[model samples]
Target chain A: MGRVVVEVMPKPEILDPQGKAVVGALPRLGFTQFVGVRQGKRFELEVEGDVTPEILAAARQAAETMLSNPIIEDVVNVFEAEVSA
Target chain B: MGRVVVEVMPKPEILDPQGKAVVGALPRLGFTQFVGVRQGKRFELEVEGDVTPEILAAARQAAETMLSNPIIEDVVNVFEAEVSA
Candidate 1:
């Protein structure tokens, strides 16, 4: 089978409280080397057969419409992968 | 300067109710072609300067310990990126 990965992330200008929380907590845990942290979501779609180029397009479309709010979010990537079971 | 992306996904054997819910909702929205759906988290770390190998290791360590529950989740990728902002 094939899989498609859609990574949805907040727009750079948007405020990400969850991400900010992680960034804030990191310093207390002695991970103070980072400048910023942005948290996002990843969706893996498993298709029954081989993934066509068209499937990638459809997956991106679905992700934009269903998985992410385009007004404040964006899809970072939509890529296909080969998988078994 | 540089960025690191950490993808944390649930173990294959784990039951992800959130992912299942999305899968169930898809069919109702006329997206019944998929077999399964898995959801995960993505962490983007923005560093000040160049991303050395040591930076990658530290980011991975931080991600494993604080960003994810390693017992039930797996890090799929920890790769560096080039970014302007």
Candidate 2:
């Protein structure tokens, strides 16, 4: 089966409390190299056959409409999952 | 500034209700081309300078310890966020 990967992230203007919490915790955990953190969502959409252009198009549409909230998030990426991830 | 991207996904053996919910909703949204779905997390860790090897290593460590639940989730990828994503 082929898989499509979609990534969605909070918009720059939006406040991400989860990310803030992570950044706050990281320093205490000794991961001080990181100055900031932003959390997002990743999805793998599996198909029965090859991931055709049509399938990618549909996945992009789904990523935009259903996977992410346009008001607060942006669909940052929509691509074929070539790697095992 | 530079960013490191960390991806975490549920282990194959683990049940992903969130993914099942998405797969179930796809058909209703006219996205029937997809057969299955898996939901995961994406984290962007921002640093003040270039994403050095040390920063990546720290991100990897954080991904394993703080970003994902080792019991049920896997840290699938840890890399520099080369693209705008």
Residue pairs that clash (backbone atoms under 3 angstroms), model 1: none
Q: Pick the candidate with the highest TM-score.
A: 2
Name the regions of candidate 1 deviating beyond 4 angstroms.
none
- Tens digits of lDDT, candidate 1, B1-85: 7898889999899998879988888877777667789999999998888888999999989988998998999888899975856
Which consecutive 10 residues in model 1 chain A have the weakest lDDT in total? Answer: A76-85
Over the full model, what C-alpha lDDT does candidate 1 score relative to the true structure?
0.88
Individual DockQ of the candidates?
Answer: 0.84, 0.91
Per prediction, fnat is: 0.78, 0.85
- Per-residue lDDT of candidate 2, residues B3-82 (tens digit): 99999999988999999999999999899999889999999999998998989899999999999999999999999987
What docking grade applies to model 1? high
Per-residue error (Å), model 2, residue B50: 1.0
Question: In the order shown, what is each candidate's alpha-carbon RMSD?
Answer: 1.3, 1.4
Best by lDDT: 2
